[model samples]
Target: MRGDTSNYRDLFLGDVPMMDARAPIEFRKGAFPHTVNLPLMTDSERQKVGTCYTQQGEAAAIALGHRLVSGQVKAERLAAWADFARAHPDGYLYCFRGGLRSQIVQTWLREEAGIAYPRVIGGYKALRGFLLDTLDRALAECGFVVLGGMTGTGKTDVLAQLAHGLDLEGHAHHRGSSFGKRVTGQPAQIDFENGLAVDILKKRHAGHAHFVVEDEGQAIGACSVPVGLHQGMQRYPLVWLEDSFENRVRRILRDYVVNLGAEFVAEHGHEQGQLLFAQRLRQSLDKIQKRLGGLRHQQLAAIMDAALAEQARGGGVEGHRAWIEALLTSYYDPMYRHQRESKAGRIVFSGDEAAVLEYLRRASTMARRPDPGTSA
Candidate 1:
């Protein structure tokens, strides 16, 4: 009781490290940020115990779990937990609901290891609940503004500069497009939600009463915005980010070509990375083939093939511009134009990147100001 805590707010805000004690399967479904899975039971062990519980009751299940985990297995788990405890003395531990498994873990540490590590009061469920509530409350109590633009107008760049900016794409680890997939995979859906909520919580704690987010749809890559936040975003005021078509093309080439190629090479060795990067580009284009239409898609694909080949030979990246220009002109721009038109009523400002960043920062400052009509 002395070390156990229910204070989810400080736990997240302080970036407290935590050890999760749920089974591996449960841990995979969702987890808090900065928390590691040092599961109480492996998937196979958990399944056996679960079956025992369903057929023979709690006493039998407990017996089965002990039998499955005793001796060397138990020693190894205890060592892993002890190592973590020694490494992070202030960290907390938890299971699904701070129930039997975590209680048992706490008891073992105290009795066998002589370490009194704290456990979260309501465990993973409560922490997750706090985050969901954090996001919902922020949507209700805080003012939010959406930054809208065609592809590569650099909405993300502007958001990075604002104090209250929420980079949903950053949280999602995506650029929010067909070509947005990173070499690394996206987080699980629950992890995405938890990350977003934690972000809002920390900002609110820092006294931000408003936020800026990109004009993203329901989904960015494999991650979806929470339903309530997405709905609330639709009604928020919008800022349209603009840039010259040539500049946009150049940006796309730099991001998707030069930079992405470098990322691949850095991740894999040069030969494999270059091969995968080329494949990724072609595959991404193929995914939109129906939308691009047969003739246009083939023409673009040919240009892309030529560009990839040229770059492979150590030619400069200028060749990428041809297909990028064509794709923007034929595909992305028209789609974004329709989206902006539909949401025209919400457009509160429009400008190039510098002007838009200035406007958002100014607006954030105004929002943080106290009302003159209120008492001092």
Candidate 2:
């Protein structure tokens, strides 16, 4: 029976002969489609069991679990299982593994209600194996197009605007920066990968010629890009966006305001935010610091301070544009130039937002063209 249990793909793709069972949190983190959580144990109960395992070993923990699940509580759990089985008549059940806990639940469900819930042979472990296998397959077979640029080039924004491609940064809920945390929350590492896997699967299913993604380091915020996927990305041709320093700064300011809102300026206080932004500016100016030393940092800081104050005082378009351009030319441009030169296989596309969007659209269309002599 265990040998005949369905794989995760079969279950998630709705090919399963039965409904699937897992815990609610686990299901939310990642789960097969059409799955249900009939938690044999609550979150606190699971935590206590884990603590017992660490302090008292598996045998003692198992005994404690049995002891804790007794009387009315046990009866209620059995009743819930009966209800679930009725609702999902052809459902199968699984715990972390096709182990004793699952056996206990299966036996109770059968004895009390005369309903048999098939158990996944290796349970969650088998599902994990399936996910890993699928990811590896995707990494090996997919054609990737890497979008590369320095900070504040709006690489993510451009990627989003492009049609028919995965947005890796969006999936990770990060801007891929020193200060990239979302205003809401970040996804757990497992959840991030699960979302990424969904995108990869969708692209593959569509027979996409290639999927576009931002050029990212090994990790994005709290989530680590899988090694296989990272390697796959590195092999693809790179598309580098070139923008004027003035334009880049304007873009960054606009992005920050849009994503973080006026409250960001208000919360940090215009003066403090100005100071921090200047400090970042100085760091970006480190190459010239040796010749100019402390004086350079101070000069840039002062300029940044004044510019930020103007913005605070409602320095409309001109003031904002001037400040952003100064920082970009005096800092971002040089840094990006050095880094961009070091990268290989780059196809440079120079333009403002609309022009860049047009370039990507053209590239995507060309990639999708059918091979000559291929059957209709």
Residue-level lDDT tens digits of model 1 in 279-340: 99999999899999999999999999999999999857899999998899889999999999
Candidates' RMSD to native: 2.9, 6.9
Residue 251 error, candidate 1, Å = 1.4
Worst 10 residues of 1 by lDDT: 367-376
The superposed Cα distance between candidate 2 and the true structure at residue 366, in angstroms, equals 5.9
Provide the clashing-pair count of each candidate structure: 0, 0
* TM of each candidate vs. truth: 0.96, 0.67
Decoy 2 TM-score against native: 0.67
After superposition, the stretches of candidate 1 with alpha carbons farther than 4 Å from their true spots are 369-376
